[model samples]
Target: MAAKTWASATRDGGQSITTTSVWSVVRRLIGYECFETDPEYLLLQSIYEDLRLYFNFFQPVLKLIAKEHMDKKVIKRYDGRAIGDHDTAAPPYQQVMAFKDVPFETKARLTNLYVQLNPAHLRTTIDAKVAKLWKISW
Candidate 1:
């Protein structure tokens, strides 16, 4: 999952402000607009996507671990669009959309993963992944 991106020191030299990602903003939007639960579909989608991206960032290490724990095919299916059930009629795949548009609980477990990751590690790790994913250099 995307980590809080911006941070600042307070007047007392303590950590002050922190900012998340555009993706996180989008997740919150999903909560207010699409899913009403605490951990929305978009959030879970972000987490799933980040997991793949970060695995690639630390290739040979985390990649192997992710491969061992998560099936390639299954992880590929974490496209956020498959949150709930499948409905292929309404918006092409109405069944899938309907399934994906359910309560946030369907995607809440991912939130636990996000909360568990250390903020410091998450930020550095995600930054590395994002940079690599975008093919940029230091």
Candidate 2:
């Protein structure tokens, strides 16, 4: 018999299920920059995966610069109208830190990492790696 996967073994009626939103964003981020060519693609899947890791490493830095709107609360009016109360636009890192359930140690670690990142350096590295990948594909 095949091994039962977590999704198949769960009984929560898909309430605990996750979506592909993260990957969809990643694909959109890299689609135009990395995969817009009509020529042959990367020779191996591992190469593409490795390149993705490089992109992921610097993604948080980009997010720090581009603040996103986050809905913190919802209010229902007497007239049955609903309104969303959003937190001031903030980076994903800041939003994560605000969550009550996140451990203090985790927050401290993330803060340490965030402070050390150099966006200019990361961008240069990403551009260099992408150019190398393009050279390989051609």
Candidate 3:
């Protein structure tokens, strides 16, 4: 996983900077900057798991679903970050339970679909007729 930051200039002369009010940054980046909280945590990714959100969610189920079809180690190598952190390495039971609104069950797969809509899409009318959709072959 790539580690990136919004404001990652804390390292200087191999020492951790406690404050971001350095004269160099004021003259260079923002011209002037002030912060209410520690910019390191806010602007910089201090936690390792910040990048692996979707990978972590799907990691648990991959083993349960794909073990017979694929190698587990190879799957981890592709889907997982180099080092496991609080997010990616966390056990599935608690994380699955943390999901809200929809009913979650132990023996069933939880399928989620997210849609991004424009105002034009909303203006289009719905078809109203309800029917079960099976596989479509053309």
Candidate 4:
């Protein structure tokens, strides 16, 4: 399992950060960037378990989905600002989920497809569907 870490900068010229610290920073960032009343977060939170189970074995696929469906400009800004500021690693989906614009139906589809697909055929199905929509082959 990946450890949740917070991203931070050291004021006193300290050593580099660990994974845990990076997660802490990201959580704090999201606290401000995302809202408590946001329905997207609530929806994603509700299905987090299903997402984790299904995507756990297909992180690359999820990344591909993010690349295709997520807002590139916003993600670019995030990477340049918040992500660049972090000294430790952060999972791609954490940043991807920050986009509340992604429809709930898409999330549902991604999660449902993962649950229904067999492992051996998972990538092909996902790739084909995503490629058809995004016009890019994996």
Candidate 5:
């Protein structure tokens, strides 16, 4: 799904999109760290695109470690005021697994993928790829 669409679907009222926040991190890695000058920056469009593809490869693994805060309930007062109560933070994988409507086979597939992931290794790979981009930019 497109990041904006996903964000719109999941975000609470008046809350900022998490995907937008995450994109800033991507921008810092690719834009700020890679290019040093305006002229050089224009020449590195291919590199930027390549690095984006590389980053996306590991993005899901990175998200495996990111905790998402889930709201459990909205408590309504006599005056019609409502407050959201959050549940414990969990990774997206766990949240999917916790869903009653998710099919058992689908959950099993996710579990299989989850077991093969190592967050430390994924981070190292992302760092190495970003460093590679830095090298190519110069």
Candidate 6:
């Protein structure tokens, strides 16, 4: 019904609307038709597409979140994308939690094991094994 009404509306200064220009305002509002040339908008669009390929289960997602605000900073940057710097400086998966507080021998041994198996594949294998051990099927 709305589309039907929009198709017959008059344009600026009482001019008849063209067939292609009917509902141009609604098209821009709903589809961001005016942002076709926006750089940040295009970048965000690409990021959204790429993120669709990444899906994973997170471990330890508990309310250790409360510990996040333990350290106060001089100023909060508000929005990461606004500053154009969203890098968390996280180490690669193989190196994550590798040498934390463990004795040199143990750390090196575990790190050697992790490196032998690629970290990404190793995580899947571990998750599968844990599921099997717990009789989890999905």
RMSD of each: 17.8, 11.4, 18.4, 18.7, 11.6, 20.2
lDDT at 18 for candidate 2?
Answer: 22
- Residue 102 in model 1: lDDT: 58
TM-score of each: 0.21, 0.45, 0.18, 0.23, 0.46, 0.23
Q: After the best TM-score superposition of candidate 4, give how far the Cα of residue 54 lies from its true spot, in angstroms.
A: 11
Q: So what's the TM-score on candidate 4?
A: 0.23
Model 6: per-residue Cα lDDT over 27-109, one tens digit each: 33233322222343333233222222111112211111122233573323322322224523333322345447767776666
Give the per-residue Cα lDDT of candidate 2 at 42: 32
Candidate 5, residue 71: CA error in Å? 23
> lDDT tens string, model 5, 5-120?
22265556543322333456467665544344544443344334444444443343212223334597434432122223333444557657768999999988877866776666
Question: Per-residue alpha-carbon lDDT of model 3 for 59-131, expressed as tens digits?
Answer: 3532222222254553333224322333244424335656575475541443231123232332221111000
Better of 1 and 2 by lDDT: 2
What lDDT score belongs to each candidate, Candidate 1 first? 0.38, 0.47, 0.30, 0.39, 0.50, 0.34
- Clash totals in order: 13, 0, 0, 12, 0, 0
Q: Highest lDDT: which candidate?
A: 5
Model 4 whole-model lDDT (C-alpha atoms): 0.39
| Superposition error at 108 for model 4 (Å) | 0.8
Output candidate 3 Cα RMSD.
Answer: 18.4
TM-score: the better of candidates 2 and 4: 2
Once superposed on the true structure, which residue ranges of model 3 sit more than 4 Å away at CA? 1-37, 45-49, 57-110, 113-138
Question: The CA-based lDDT of model 5 is what?
Answer: 0.50
**Candidate 1: C-alpha lDDT:** 0.38
